[model samples]
Target: MDTPSYRERLNRVLRYIENHLDDSPDLEALSAVACFSPYHFHRIFSAMVGESVAAYVRRLRLERAAMQLSLSDVTITQVALAAGYDSLDAFSRAFRAQFKVLPSAYRRNDGPLEQARRYSIGQPLFYHLAPDVPPIDVQIRSFAPMWVATLRYTGPYDDCYPAWETLMAAMQTQGLLTVDTFACAVSHDNPDITPVDKCRMEVCLSLPPGMTANTLAVRNLLQDKRIYLRVIGSNSDYAVIEVNGPYSLLHPAYRSLYWQWLPQSGREPDDDPGFEVYYNSPQSTEPQDLRTGIFIPLLMG
Candidate 1:
């Protein structure tokens, strides 16, 4: 299948899985959703998503159980069964293997933020915000649609520097980089749910107004470097937060936005993926001096 078509189909399957986590979706059912043959669907899904369908589903279910453990007063047995485990023993074994903590201990010791921190223990690029951190200031803004040249990286978040470097070098070599060039990173998976090594990230550089992927130069550049061109839709309303600090703070900032602020904001997030735009280069800026804008598209009536 062509890239865009396959991507769209897989994305549909992903949404279906997210919405129906309680159901055990078999390969044939999911393949039907993606319009791919059962024989090839698993291969395609594993290649594109960096995980087998079963692994993806199990990870999501476990992560959902974790959220329920921290956010609700549900019993361990209830959470385990809800997660599709046959018994508490089975659930405890699976949960401990993935999270390195017993359900009771995890629930007893952590809230949402603390749970986030616990999951991020080994990932140095992620950090949990202190409970005393100041309240986040959110602004609703409008963004125009734009085209971007993108390079994908699949690994730990902090290890994505090479993708940025390669993409920047390519753009500069193609005379596409300018003083006003807009750059952003698209995170395709939740680090909390997806294993760090399998996380997908896209480093993007906005194309000029009149430029497009079909342009001879852009097309050749993309083909030569195995990069992709994508169009980000305009958002009439997006809840945006300006983050000032190291990249490590981004994950927690997002958690704060989703778990803390969004619940009380009286608005829902649109389907578009959230992204971060950097205002300063990490190479030259102090860790504490870096500025980043986190944009979450908002649903509109």
Candidate 2:
């Protein structure tokens, strides 16, 4: 579900459903979120979101129920109905479907994540939900022809005020980047990622077609891969975090990079190659280096 803006849309719908759960958030109300027709919302959402809308909502509610069951002293019947199950039997049935055990059993026993682990669907071998991963450095390859919108600059790396000036001007001259589907920064000798003295950052510009004709922005993209301490956390406030390292300084972030970031982000690593996409490219050593995301293969430990 890390497909750029996928979560944005999904969250909108999920939130709508949650607030209106009692009202039975049918396809019509939810479909208006992304403006897609009801006929296609479910399938498209399920495919891109890694779980069905109904399934996601159900699991979320069930997870909430488990939490409430553990904390509240209410009877199982009360907890079941509170979680939106029609009856204790139905609640128990769905609970088992999610936790693989009955609510009574779970409450009687005392394992928080144990029962939830049984139903961790779409879980990668080692992915977890890490919110703020500490920073680290690793080796990364470089590339060219990458696309980006940028604010031009010519100044010392330590004081990048001039760069910001350009960005402010651009942001003012052109409308804000909300128009761009994605944001990126193209850095000429990016300093944060590299040890370069002088630098330039080309912010990824997002605008409608034909706007580029009169702008002082660059169109082509510079491609490069960066290895950094990557932390993946949920979008929530109390997000969990996974920090990864490459032992570049001989102290690997953890025994297993996969072991560390995977379970921490609470997400399984997907097959597609993941790269750090930067909206404001860190001052990389290479002029083309924007922020390079840490993309890794979630190999089994």
Which candidate leads in lDDT? 1
The TM-scores of all predictions, comma-separated, are: 0.69, 0.38
Q: Model 1 lDDT vs. the true structure?
A: 0.79
Worst 10 residues of 1 by lDDT: 123-132
- In the order shown, the candidates' Cα RMSDs to the true structure are 6.2, 16.7
Q: Please identify model 2 stretches exceeding 4 Å from their true place.
A: 1-7, 21-23, 111-301
Pairs of residues clashing in candidate 1: none
Predicted structure 1, TM vs. truth: 0.69
Candidate 1 residue-wise lDDT, 118-199, digit = tens: 6645542133454434557889998778899887677899899988988888888888888878889888667875578967
Alpha carbon lDDT of each predicted model = 0.79, 0.46
Per-residue accuracy of model 2 over 183-243 as CA lDDT, tens digit each: 4333333222222342333334344444443344322111111101112222222211222
